[model samples]
Target: MEPHAARPLEGRLALVTGAGQGVGRGIASCLAAAGATVAVNDLAPTRADAVAAEIRDAGGDAFGLAFDVTDADAAQTAVGDLEIDILVNNAGVPPGGGRPNRFAQMPPEDWQLQIDLNLAALMRLAQLVIPGQAERGWGRIIQISSGASSRGLAIGVAAYGAAKAGGEALIRHLGVEYGPEGITANSLALGLMEGVGRAGDPAVDRLIRGVPIGRLGRPQEVGEACVWLASEAGGLVNAQVIHLNGGTVFGR
Candidate 1:
């Protein structure tokens, strides 16, 4: 067998948003390792360039593209004339970055921010990439969602959950509508993750204890899942919400 035979994503170009740190960074690294040239996007130019440099230092092909995913003009120009075979929507408001407010207490403006960041931004990028993908007759759309999309959280992030759910719904429709054109749309509803999960923090012990796997999900693991979805092996898995929450009951 050829040494590079295991690189299923060879010759593909992947664009990963918010890839400066945390989950996005992990995904970008993994995609590059899987033989895909990656375009790392982040709001901060330094971060995007840093991650792209890391990938190249590791002997992979990548470049940083700094732009806010929510900005329509910026998002459009970022992908101009580039043949992106895979699009990983990983940019969004961090779980606790937004003030926690119940729907009743959340001001309309605050909730609207959630919708714009989590769902609308995703739609914008998809709109920009899907046409080219269709023309090529091969594409992969991987959405990084949250467990809150499927279950209610008592933490006052109703808007966040709703926005994620909305994105998933869009993914379902896209999967069905474009399946005939060899494009697959899928959502990965993630559970608590290592970097994002705040593992070892006493405050979240109860949440950790609830996980059957007795651990937190790793960002690298999420990247591995993306590789599968973007590879030939995942051709048939479309419009499905796959959970990556360490066997949480909510996932089941």
Candidate 2:
């Protein structure tokens, strides 16, 4: 859709974390295309700037904001002056960068790292953005979670799953508490995406066979979903986890 063609998020500003590549980049691109001025964030300045430039090259408004979301001081400094109407908490990773480690074998430090990045950082960003949103009488908080969140105690990703579940739980509470204030909170529990889950890989192929869609999801699809949820049409939804897996799993 063209930016001038009845765009729902025109005049809004959105902050998308970890937006340098993959799913975050896709979300940022879509939000900009939907007429939202996007704050493209990444820990790396170059990556953030690149994505922002990509949006601008496509005729959308955007600017890069580089800061580690896990660093409270940095995050505050980066976002304190901006009036963000939408916050997309998409920065996260499992311990060892998604390498599998059993719960019993995982160290406490690893567990803390998982929580800090996956759960604590989310709350921190929400804290920074929600108050301004409340003052303005509108806001949207969207979490990019994993399918492991609702799967319940998976063998190799116990800590990661737990942290994601905690984030979802927090979203539910925020939805109920802030709904009257015109703020909506929800989570998009993802399955596998193109780069993240390749089709030719043996394990991914096995997983794809089980998926009713018979393919890995594209990042733009996730982006489109974020656009809808951030728009007025998705206002009725709150405190809910919308699964984006291709029928590989179901229900929150």
Candidate 3:
């Protein structure tokens, strides 16, 4: 393959969760554009198929797989036969039903939901691919985290925040354990990205004002970052959290 060919990820296989729309869909499309055959996983079969069709229409190889990440049996059944070179864990639920609420008022089920989907489910999916990745001597695991994981920017997201923080910790641990085997793991802690989560909420304007960049982040920006991190150019960058919050928060 030519060094600068449009398909740098040619021959690779990637799986992106919650790729029916929003940030997940963007990342899936970007991966496919780089020449990877992509599996777009989403809870809704129709949505997943739509996004996958879009990728195919754009001349990229893609297919939709529907399964709830929190469902272990379903996840295993959907992903068992695939040889995935890249994994992007982007499925998650917004805190308090997309509205801020006091932690005191948060329901127990809400907290457990976040923990199961954002953290535990991620581990389950990673387990399916890490062994193969280690044996093959190459793999990329990217987690889509939130600014709340490390910052106080948002309110009433204690459960979500805690879950994401745990996810970041897991990424660091995975990096250390798998780095020598050529499997890199990292997390992207994003803030106020356009069209993602509750970006259109009235409270978002206040949040955006605090960002030094003076604007909401674009989904495409996140997608490009994923492409780089999953490519050879980012081989040495591991066990790190790349803040995509437009400088809203600094440091780990």
Sum up the clashes in candidate 3: 0
- Model 2, residue 133: distance off in Å is 0.5
Supply the global lDDT for candidate 1: 0.89
Model 2 worst lDDT window (10 residues)? 92-101
The model with the greater TM-score, 1 or 2, is 1
Task: List the candidates' TM-scores in order.
Answer: 0.94, 0.94, 0.92
Candidate 3 Cα outliers beyond 4 Å, as residue runs: 1-5, 94-100, 196-202, 250-252
- Where does candidate 1 clash, by residue pair? none
Cα misplacement distance, residue 211 of candidate 3 (Å):
1.8
- Residue 83 CA displacement from its true place in model 2, Å: 0.3
Tens-digit lDDT string for candidate 3 (21-71): 888899999999988889999989999999999999999999999999999
Q: What is the TM-score of candidate 2?
A: 0.94
lDDT of 3: 0.86
Q: Name the top TM-score candidate.
A: 1
lDDT of candidate 1 over 1-252, digit per residue (tens): 111657889999999998999889999999999999999999999999999999999999999999988788888888867888999999877534788787898999888988988899999998888999999899999999999899987788899889999999999999999999989999999888775445577857877788899877788999999999999888899999999988894431
Q: For each candidate in the order shown, give its overall lDDT on alpha carbons.
A: 0.89, 0.88, 0.86
Ranking by lDDT: 1, 2, 3
